[model samples]
Target: MTDATANTAPAGAGQGSLLIKDSRTAKRNGAEGRFKMYGLIAVCIGIAMLILLLTSILTSGLSAFWQTTIQIEVTLPEEKLDKSGVRDPEVMAKVTTFGYAPLLRDGLEATIAANGIETELSAKDAAELISDESVAQLRNRVLRNPDLIGQTVSVEVMASGRIDGFYKGRVTYASAERDTNISPAQLQLAEALEDKGLLNTSFNWLFLTAPDASDTRPEAAGLGVAILGSLYMMLIVLVLALPIGVAASVYLEEFAPQNRWTDLVEVNISNLAAVPSIVFGILGLAIFINFAGLPQSAPIVGGLVLTLMTLPTIIIATRAALKSVPPSIRDAALGLGASRMQSVFHHVLPLAMPGILTGTILGLAQALGETAPLLLIGMVAFVREYPEAPWEGGLFDPATALPVQVFNWTQRSDPAFVERASGAIIVLLVFLLLMNLTAIFLRRRFERRW
Candidate 1:
């Protein structure tokens, strides 16, 4: 009996030894520390790449925020600004920007002489060193307020793009030989004027408030008009896309049966989300612009195109959100004699709202940065005037979006417009970042777990 008991104990110890061997084998087959470290290195590399991208954008874009300006005291003789002391609108209409050029030239000459700067530059050349927009600006103000037409007013005028670049060290005298807009003489005069405090650099509010200018008026160009156009398009997108997308998502996720037709729809939606944005632009051009006869280059058409593109993303997100709600919760609500709609609307939808909002904002950010679609829809056309009310002539009027404006500026020959393009990009990126941040905030604020 003792021998038999000893034999059973040895067998039990052998089985335990086998189990320990198997456990050791499993640990040996698991991922190694080196493999895990490789993943960590990959993540670190990705973060470094992201930092490099941000640093490049910020460095190139920071210069766009400031501009060179010249402060001039100009005596607007009543003869030029207001031909008739009676302030006749007809007389003011006849006075062109050219009429104000002489006054600016005179002011520049006075400034140069007063500063005792010895230069061979003529008054015309000195004034040309400043922006042509300044002439128009002075003329417009005098016409608007005829009371100031005869008075000597202190005005701060934007410097010419080349002059501005020169002052900022972006354009040196050596580079000016290739530039047709400015010369070394102009640069020297600008330096002399800077020394006398008549010319200086300051934060460029006009870049935010003014509109796009001609190729010759880069210093005068601003993002205000394009920003408005983008806003209008977004307004249209939000008003139309959000409700329709959410409704479709709810029906598909909560009520639609798992049929072949539903399957086809789901598959097609996923494909549409993957379609290139340029395809949507082509679709918009064919359907909205050519076939439907919607106004070309209008924000309305742009909005419609963006709405179609954004819908797939929003629907996918909303459905995912709805699916995240626990099935037990839905069953409980239904078992309490609540309708399917009631169960979804009361329990499921509230839980899904945060995800839905986050997705919508991300989609809108995508739309905001879209340039290819706008390019196809004639948003590349130059727009000089602001559109009217949304319900009025707005949908038919020519408009330029921010991205489109940036694209247009980059294509110009002027170096200053490059800076303007960079500035526009900065503005667009700010909007995109804000939208993304809002998505993050929404996710954190309303996220729930079952």
Candidate 2:
């Protein structure tokens, strides 16, 4: 009996076998612990990088929201603006921006004199402190209100980009000395105007409302045209891509036969999803513009291109969402004598709505930030006028997109335009974040688990 028990007993099981961990167990535990440590380090590194990116973006771009302006009272002598004294808008409009330029120069000189501020700079040099857009703006204002002729009205004119940059720390006195567009004397005069409360920095509504200015007038440049163009294209994409993509997805996922042709189509759709966005741009340029004779730089053309690019994304996501719906629900609906179509439409689709909407919005967001395709479609053109309303042929009108605007600004020689480019990035980021949040909200509000 003792020998039988000894033979049955395991070797080396007496002292440390049960209480002490084996070498293999300890090695696995050590490996797992190291993996956890590595994952933690990776997460920390990602957070630090994100903080650095946000900090840099906010610091450089926030200043673009504030504009340096010089407020001055100008006496619009009737002889200069409307010699007929008829208060005719047509007659007032006859005086071009060049004709209005002298009045602004005189206005600045008079404001200095009235403020009791003394400066050695000539009247022309002081006028140089104002933006090139000021002349055009004043002209438009006078034309809009012809009665202002022969009356003294207060006008707030934008400071030149150099003068603006000085206050925003983009330019210094030393830098102004080297800049051809500005001088140290001009900056000193700007300082005097500030001391007297004539020059000030305030929220620039124009940055949000006004159109893009020329290379010489960065302070007058705004995101208005770009914003509107993006809105119009988004509307187009949503109107077109959502229905087409979802229908195609439904037909493929629920109704199509599992045949070689369907399999080939499926593979091609996946391939299209992986295709470079610029290829779509080239396709748009060839098909929409070159062959179809559609207007170049039109939002309509851009929307079509983006729609083609976005359809694949929406289709893929919709198919995935549809597949996530449990097969049991469909089986139950069929067991109740419902048609296959009815089962999918009534039971399967409702369950998939949240993901469908999320995918559609995310696809739209991706299309919004797309630059290469838009560039190929000629959306990079400098567009000064707002597109007409949709009913008034607006979508076909020449326009610029936000990403295209950013690209345009970065190509300019002015540092102020660079700042504007950064600001545009911030705006773009906000738009993306809002879109992602909307996706989350819709997912939570409508998503159901079966």
Candidate 3:
């Protein structure tokens, strides 16, 4: 064949090859476009789910922050709260909440009469419209300070949970017919009082500051004690877990010889991360409570349990961070005759601090929302009194953590406790959110590029 003819044949073969390559490229690009679309759809679904969750929580939990209060202008009788007209503790002890109820009823009745809001409700029904704890609250004030016994002071008392619901439009006349704590007539009287401004609904700061009360007094119940308990537990976890976790990571990553033992330990740490949290609860119960003889429901025990649960998480993150550090940096330090500890601590650790902190905070956040381990330690029990002190009560006293408190509230027979439970959840979420945001901030602040 001629040379030109042979060249043309070769060119034709090359053109065929180009066509095949173009077709494959087009098919690959189409597949990539479809994958991108799938990712976008998944992200949209996630955002929609988050929005729904927040809306539901806000709608159900918002009512717990505002409570109906009956403003009573009462003349504190000297004989009731302070019989001796002196600040005597013995005399105050003799008087009970019942003794203070009549005085409160008379004051409320007088206020109603003065307001010209005529109702056929008896004094007992009128007092029932307000909170039963109001009497005890006033009596406690007089017992604390006898100077206020004869003074006419205006006290804003919480209304009964049912009455409060009535004012908030949660309980209607038809619903009152089936309710035992409130009747249709009582709701009607409450509305009348609300109209005259004697009873009104406002934001309740007490819910954030006061301690949890009985189921009958949901309006008075607060998550403050639980919040403090969780704080103490977190403090213990932070102090105990961070150092131990970092130390283990440092030794494993920089100094420890890679042997079968080390490999086994690494595998077990990873496995522990995936273990069921309730299993940790069981372990904590058997080891800490039964064997160690630690106090039941103490924040210290809860902290120790959480520490065990959190250590694996921190260690994994820390090791990953240490691995991310450039070997060149370590070599440079060593070439300058710096000791191994100095090189690791001064250069490597500072670089890895962000990741370590992020991991630690994330683990703590997980511990904060934990309920099962706390339940095993008796943190689910009813605790009315505030803990004495961190050092005094933290190790020995019975305390309820926030998640356990929320769980306890949900199991109550009263509907108001459900609202309180939702409120407690909101508080817990806020705490978790704050911790997560802190982790993000630290990560961004201290992150280094190799």
Give the RMSD in angstroms, all C-alphas superposed, for model 3.
4.6
Expressed as tens digits, the lDDT of each residue in 48-75 for candidate 1 is 9999977776666667789899988888
Best by lDDT: 2
Relative to the true structure, how large is the alpha-carbon lDDT of every model? 0.86, 0.91, 0.86
lDDT of 2 by residue, 72-155 (tens): 998888888888888888767788888889999999999999999888989998899999898888888888888788888999
Candidate 1: where is the Cα deviation over 4 Å? 1-31
lDDT of 2 at 175: 88
TM-score of each: 0.91, 0.95, 0.94
Off by over 4 Å in 3: 1-22
Model with the higher lDDT, candidate 2 or 3: 2
Candidate 2 deviant stretches above 4 angstroms: 1-18
Clashing pairs in 1: none
**What is the C-alpha local distance difference test score of candidate 2?**
0.91
Worst 10-residue lDDT window for candidate 3 reads 1-10
